[model samples]
Target: MKTISKWLALVVTVFLVLAGCSGGGDSADSGKGENGKVQISFINGFTGGDGAYMKKITDAFNASQDKYEVVELQEKDHYTKFKSGEYDLVVIHGNNLETYKQDGLIQDMSSVLEKAGIAETDFHQAGIDTVKLDDTMYAVPLDIHPLTMFYNKEFVQEAPKTYEDLVKINDELQAQSKDLYALGVPSSGLVEFYMLMIAAQNGIDLEKDGYLNFAQPEYAEALMQFHDMVWKDKVSPAGLGLDGEFQTFMKEAQEGKAYQTAVALTGPWFYGGAKEKYGDNLGVAPIPQIGSQLAAYGNSHTIALPANVKDEEKLAGIAEYLKFMYTPENLINWADGGQAPVHLPTLEKVTAEQEKYQIAYQNSQQFDDYVSAPQVYQFGEQIRYMNESVFSKVVTTEKLTTDALMKELEKATEMAKQIAATAPQQ
Candidate 1:
């Protein structure tokens, strides 16, 4: 009887351990929705006013069908969450696609896109290209946001068509003593982005084969032009940071100040604030042709799937969700949050159907000709640091010469190369 009691006790302990392990496994798996709906977790960093628009879309999608339901995880560092298998889908910056692919973190979506009947030709070529690597597509482009020009229509008759025109306008405005300048330049890292855009327009390559090459004459010329704008032309102030410039423009417009800035260089997201402040005076246009050709700095947001999402049913559900989101009927909904759809068909539809902000939509379409800066993984911060250090000094203190800036760029490039070399191989 004593031996039988001991055996019963051991059996109970083993059963309890097995049950606990099973419970842990079940908790890690995705839960089913009512009537066997496949629940998919989506993670993104859209915690601003845009979040509401995203939620609207998600709710609409949920109501449109009963097979799948999307759960949003809004937070910063979405990639980290995705790695933990808590989310099956992520919306990330297009530039990060390459790095994620190299790390084998994202799944190749060519098959998924094909299954959803979405072709590469269906999207804006520039946007589609951002998510492709060596003929393989890994993500779907959601929207294109480019650096553009916004002007006060009451002061400026029309947008400046060329670089010379910009200077002339500034000179004329300053002479009128109407308190208006030709342009309101921001003293921030974005100045470097503008310089890169000009360099690209001139056919100068700042990055070549995973290396930085700022020794080109075109780069120097672009820098010289920026320097002239600040110091020689005096059209823009010396020390107004991005926030200061934005506030100055808004305050001047609100007060009906005749001497307000005529033009401001910013992104599409600025439309809401500018419209609120300027009312009917706000005018949107592509950034003026600063170099030999028309070019602007641009980037995109993309939807990507993680490699861990291997379930066929889940993939199908995700494909359907994406298809729904990109449908022509729903694409225009993104405009509510100031996002320009990356789908070419949707863009055309918006241009024809949406008249309230037609110019803003048209300007966003110009991103097809825009140039994206180099996106070196784990090295972007270092490059930005170098750019800010050099550009801020040049714009504010006028102390860094072109030669000194070049030397500093070379050093930064060397440091970037070293970091790249030590990065883990995919």
Candidate 2:
């Protein structure tokens, strides 16, 4: 319900371009030239209605300062273009950063910050961790996207506080012929790996120090529960196509069929839909815990000045702007598109606008229970595979088990290592 100023919106508009499309104007104005504005190029993967909101944020920033200008490019082609020396700065998901860094597209941020006299200790530990490669920083953290649970108030007034509670509610709903269930986890091979993070909140690790941990009893137990949810309970929909799963899950939530879902496991964009659809009827909370701790999916949108960028002052301005973005005021203003901030201190302070975001924001705190999978490239893909493969074996395939799940995870981890090893060195 918060309205963004026009200038900030413009920046958001230009940064949301996906990697393969050409949309929007190719406007380059750095506040100098004829109009006396500074121009900087920004690229991101917003690519949807969220792009419009991002643009609003950009427009606001541009209007506020004449020292620098930002030229927005559809980010779909940014990585390719960034490697080719096309932009001044880029905002992108941290998971793909390894590939970029390995290829020498983005400069090591820790080195840049040191050269710029910025201290790493100043930023949030978790936030910094999201931007790391073997403990070396490569990007500035902008936001941390984590899984949040959104459920229908009309169908289920009391949201589950734990995973077991969700199962109980699902059973109750089924017995009552409410035909409502708990969640519609994604069906992708990577999904299982993501689920491991959920399992980790309970002390399960699928891979540790580059070794397979899926064979652990805790890991297997956690996966079996997921298998039970999909197969034995039949809480989730069957034969739902992957492409439409997100939409279908949201639709069911809106229609009061399913009670909850793990959609948008990495960002806040998912909550925007429910807010628009259900208003006060929706409830957002950190993902429920399974055993002794809580965990949720976590990923990051990283900030990095491109190697080709030469304007020192402009880069400084951006650093200042990054600082501003983390403040409660600016963060609340720009908490759309599912990208939640990683600053715990800033998050603790709240306002009415932010309270709406709290539904998703609060749950993101549990992300530490599971290392931001994106932080580990192989693990991220492994999660995607885990979620899908586990769900399929349980729901669709009906042959999923603890041992089977372990093998799948081991195989995926090996594949991830292979990808990392073969990746071009930066």
Top-scoring candidate (lDDT): 1
Model 2, runs deviating above 4 Å: 1-36, 110-123, 189-194, 207-221, 243-267, 310-314, 323-327, 336-338, 344-354, 364-370, 377-391
Angstrom error of the Cα, residue 397, model 1: value is 2.8
lDDT for each candidate structure: 0.72, 0.58
Q: What's the C-alpha lDDT at position 374 in model 2?
A: 43
TM-score of each: 0.87, 0.76
- Clashing pairs counted in every model: 3, 59
Tens digit per residue, CA lDDT, model 2, 16-39: 655235553322223244576556
- The Cα error of candidate 1 at residue 74, in Å, is 2.2
State the displacement of the C-alpha of residue 213, model 2, in Å, after optimal TM-score superposition.
6.6
